[model samples]
Target chain A: MPQRYAYLGPQGTFTEAAMRSFPGADEAEHLPYATVPAALDALRRAEVDLAVVALENSVEGSVPTTLDELATGEPLQIVGEAHLPVSFALLVRPGTDLGDIKTVASHPHAQPQCRRWLAENVPHAEWRAATSNAEAAQHVADGHYDAALAGSFAAARYGLSVLAEDIHDVADAVTRFIALRRPGTPPPPTGTDRTTVVAFIGEDHPGALLEILTEFSMRGINLTLIQSRPTGAGLGSYLFWIELEGHVDDARVGEALMGLRRVCADVRFVGSYPRADQVRPEIRRGTHDQDFTEAAAWLASVRSGHA
Target chain B: MPQRYAYLGPQGTFTEAAMRSFPGADEAEHLPYATVPAALDALRRAEVDLAVVALENSVEGSVPTTLDELATGEPLQIVGEAHLPVSFALLVRPGTDLGDIKTVASHPHAQPQCRRWLAENVPHAEWRAATSNAEAAQHVADGHYDAALAGSFAAARYGLSVLAEDIHDVADAVTRFIALRRPGTPPPPTGTDRTTVVAFIGEDHPGALLEILTEFSMRGINLTLIQSRPTGAGLGSYLFWIELEGHVDDARVGEALMGLRRVCADVRFVGSYPRADQVRPEIRRGTHDQDFTEAAAWLASVRSGHA
Candidate 1:
């Protein structure tokens, strides 16, 4: 059966770029929505078989709207994850000199990626907000702009020339995307794997949070990230977002999570997935210098529980 | 010495409403920034002695910008929390009929609260995004739109008339605001209190989440709410936002938090403040209604766990 997937798109959205990495692309249908919530709705109503949504960007934090929908909407299992290495470009109408431009337009997320370049080179240009990077390119085509900070794909798709390539401050700017479906048994692990989960608990008092962390630590389990949102139930209560190393079926993993349940008033398991490969040539072979010192230090500390 | 303060302002913003509740209001020197990050930066640079920022809203989840800043920036202590009830109105030009309004403009957060009302009453109107509610009101005053959805205070401030009051589908809508400052000894707690904390960890696994929750349940500590965000690390770690009853000094709380620290790799205590009275009127000598039901349920549940 053909699978229909919805993403934030006109084309060239980092989400669109990530969604392209899905396996068996020929059999999957693709659709674009203006906002994350709209994409989730289409998935909820069975309008689509799968939804590829941008969960987080390396420079920015989690996309809250997507996270909120996941927290409150019907349970959806995250069947797959992708880490798309993002490289940004400054796109402009052909023959327009960079110095002649007086304004730059792009989505909020893209603006930050190009901040340093804009600050140093085009500091005085007005920064305008558009719905998406692709939309920003379309705006450049539809009207006059000094230029736009967008993706390489967006520039090509809109037929705009890349005035400057890879203008982002970080060479390894990547976005992590997730594919969600109605809850089902996780597909058999193919070599490498990762799992995701969500939970709600108290935030106030002294020992409440520590108790949850100790369970994994005691068993040598590692946690990836933890996020929270207000439950609108006054103070002291929150909706917690958590991810840890290993699969749910791993003996120690199951034991540790069950232990967390005993201490948290309420806990929910979102889903587990395969950790995306990090050494793809497209991601690692860019012209940028390969400096992993800071990343290595941070990861080592985290792996050692000292971070 | 007069303290420096920051609030979401331009006047008529819900943040302004929340900031009004702070102590030393008359003596504090105030600065208004267009966004939460701007204000948070002012605090981080020590340009301001304190900042009052909106963390969450009843209709929306955690403000991602606020949580992200707290997660990444210099250490900040959550000194207090407050709940400000939000009631919205539909304001229009003096002579415009409600049916004739073609567009409704407002800050993005205000859109959800008025969604149902707008859907049913003015289904065809397009929604415009504005910088703030007061700005939306000013837009209407300038006749850019036939109407706008805004707070009554905004309308009054901008000299617009309310075409309809309490137009939000949820009557008791409210926002949770957090008062933040550099780490300092909070004034001693009065009897009524709550504590908030954020936890970050380095693993991404399934039951790994439950392990963290068990700490609170075993000690009979009642949790209020939990929310999570990715920490922008490649390891897939999360920053968990949690709330719970009791204060830092309580024996049970101290023990529970100690237990949790063993589980979470990194944890920061965001705040512990007097649990402001919940959203229901303290003395609504009237028939049993929805607010009564909600408030009663909240109080009963907390009292049950404390017992």
Candidate 2:
């Protein structure tokens, strides 16, 4: 039997493009859902073998919806990730001039990316949000809006003409998408790997956050991203979404996780997967597995008065 | 002769309030400058004996203007700090209604704090930036703008009526201000103290940041703040502004500074002063001054085969 994969789409969305770029995506069944919740729900209900959703954007930090899902819901194992260069295109009916656009449609994430561009190019246009960029392009095809901001690849599929391509206020923006499945054994550590976890503060103390950070730092692990989100408990309370270098199987990472458990109120293990960039950290001298083993041996000898 | 103090003001800005909160502020000559650079420049040229500037805000993180000044040019010692609760007010001509406002003037920092409120209350108003909040209030008094976002305390000073007070997107936002002087003896170490330093990465490496963090973590010091700013060399190049607990005089802190010198290309020491809230860290075992002293003695004896 073949694996079935679900991604946010009507096809040609950034998530779909990212999903198609995965190593084994071509051999699986590709299904499109209208929103991230729907796609992930399909995987949760076992209707799909895996689901792909955008995790973080270089220009915008983490997607709030995805962060909330990862922080709460039933556990899911992130098996892999893909990076897609995000560039938007303005899609319009053939022969439509930029001045003719009074209302523009786009997904919320894409609006901020091209805010300055849209304000400058079509100063009179009003923005309308859609579920996805490809959905916006479809709405434009159906004459719901004068223009749509979407992937250029989406224009042809939705029977719209590309008015402009590669539009962005910032250059070299990339969105990172991750593939998740029902909790299972994580893929084998690839040496160059990334581990992610959500740490909840045990109590409101001046050093709670610092304690969590020291766990990883003392073991020579490097963090790539750390975001604080309100835990809905109230103001002044926050939970952190942390991504760091190394697989949980690594001795340093495992020790750090144990340290986190002791400091945090409750520690949620998201997943440890191979890093997309494959950049390996230079393991420092005292943080190696052998170093820990040797230190433990030395401590035992001293404790037994046999030094 | 009494000392002269410089702060950003025409009068009634948040900085002035913070300056007034200082223990010896009433004994000094208060001189107001138009901008942060101007106030610091006055001190740099010895025109003013000291200067007070906002350093960081609980809600907004580090103030960019202060960070840039602290990172470069002639170094000054931060001898004391004050934390002020920030709340804004809208000042307008007497008898002016909110609907009568067509333009809003404020310092760049004030605008974002009231953006959502203004959008809901005065959707037609255009935003204008002023150098300081007090300057904005003065402009409104001069009839240059319909309204200004400033402190309520400015209303009486500028002869403008307060349209609204206590305007904030988030409550309990506190801005931390620092008092600086030309190179002098640092304040003696208080049990509760914070030391700040800026570390420049020598070369691009995967764990450069992690290594710097471990130096402090291994010694059981807690970091209160860490912000990474671009070194202006390129995108990946960065310098970190770090504030950690414990004065530079602490044995653990001294060793951590030595470790940082070995790893970083350059480390700039900012003065350590008593914490505003006076929260002391729990000194863990193996990291106290006596622990370091005893360990050194033990090593020396062992090297001489007299252990």
Candidate 3:
């Protein structure tokens, strides 16, 4: 049987495009889920071999549902990641004209991306929401709505016309999606990788976060992203979500995690996976696998007090 | 003449409620805008003396619209903040029964907050979007929809009956709203205060952030919130939003800001304002005005090489 993979769908959504871009995905059996949690739950239940869900967007910092779900329940390991450049087109029925477009439909996330274009070109249209951009196009195709803001692929798949192309407010919008599997050993470090973790402060005290950062700073680790989400206990309580450069297999990263565990109430390891960004700075001159091995040998020799 | 104020509305929305809670708000002229940017733009244009906008929600983290507006264009300073406990109620036309409700209308934000309740109680209801929660109730009252998820105030304002009460998914959900005025001197320190600033890393060096945090860690500053937003230029670039204890008037905080200015490409000060959380641990044991004054005098005496 072909390996089963799940993605948020009703087909032709950006997520489906991302899943299709994965290696060997064309040969895999694809399953569609109505929501992010549903797809993740299917993976957890072993209904599929892998799952893909959007984690963050360049325009919208993080997807709250994805973040909250990953923070709780049975832990899921992120095995890989994909970056998709997003561009939305104004989709409408074949004979629909600009003046005939009265109600614009799309997923809530898609609306804001084309706010400027909508305001400038079609200022009088009423905004309507749908489950997905493809669903929005499907509605337009079915005459449920006059127009929609969706992917070009969605327009093609749903048999809708591209009334206007590349209408997103930002030209370089990108969304980062993660591939997840049931908790297990992460992929081997690829020299260019990112490790994600959630840290709960041991106590609400002044300088608590400083201590957490100190561990990584002293080890020469670089943070790619950091965000704080409320713990749901109260207004002031929060859990820090951090993404840093390095893999758990790296000695410096392993030491930092150990130090964090000692200082935090609990540290939830999301996973270490190859970073999605294609452009990255060259690895630091002095820090790599061979350098760490040499340093470890030097420390061992000095411990005998015979250097 | 009364001072004019603007908030996200068509009236009866939570933003309006938060605006009304501001001191002396009743005496001010209230203007309702259809969106957050509209209200802030009105303030920038001098159409309003102040603007009130939702900043963060306990469950949703930061509002991207508000954060991006604050980070760009002509800067607006946050003068005050309000904490409103959010509780959604199901509003329906008089004599409408639960089984009779086939469609539920609400603002997108309200819909998600009651997702669990709706899924459990009214599993078959089709969700519809409205301009605002109050507007949702208004539609239901006008016989356009069967029910809405809105605040109790909205139900009363729209002359609708509450069919179900307190339907929010999280019991402790609260939204933090900030009062903004044209860039000016911030309000004086309240002994308990927070200073917010946005920092752009000068160079994408390995430990650029560590250098920025060191300035605060050495001074024992406690960070209340921290988030990174893309600069919109491309994928890897980001602007860090930071909220830390101490007013800008406080010596340590002022010094930290100065230090950040030296290291960062640019630092934008959002404002120094009193926090919204009602219960707070007494400001750190000895970091108040008296201690700072005494320490200054002691340093002067010791500089003479005599005590």
Q: Write one digit per residue (lDDT tens) for candidate 1, span B36-136.
A: 88888788889998888888888787888888788767768777777877678898877778789899999888888888889998999999999888788
List the TM-score for candidate 2's chain B: 0.92
Model 2 steric clash total: 0
Better-scoring candidate (lDDT), 1 or 2: 2
**Cα-based TM-score, every candidate:** 0.46, 0.51, 0.50
The TM-score each candidate achieves on chain A is 0.85, 0.92, 0.93
Candidate 2: residue pairs that collide: none
Misplaced by over 4 Å in model 2 are: A233-237, A300-307, B1-307
Candidate 3's DockQ is 0.01
**What's the residue-level lDDT of A131 in candidate 3?**
93
| Candidate 1 accuracy as TM-score | 0.46
Go through the candidates in order and give the clash count of each.
Answer: 74, 0, 0
Q: Between the candidate structures 2 and 3, which one is better when assessed by TM-score?
A: 2
For this target, which candidate reaches the highest DockQ against the unseen true structure? Answer: 2
True contacts kept of 3: 0.00
Q: In candidate 2 chain A, where is summed lDDT lowest over 10 consecutive residues? A: A298-307
Clashing pairs in 3: none
Question: Tens-digit lDDT track for model 3 on B1-307?
Answer: 9999999998889999999989779999999999899999999999999999999998888999999899865788888899888788899988889999999999988877888899999999999999888899888988899999887888778888899997788988999999999877777777778888898864578877877787676556788888888877677677889989878777567645655655567778888888776334244433445545554443333222232
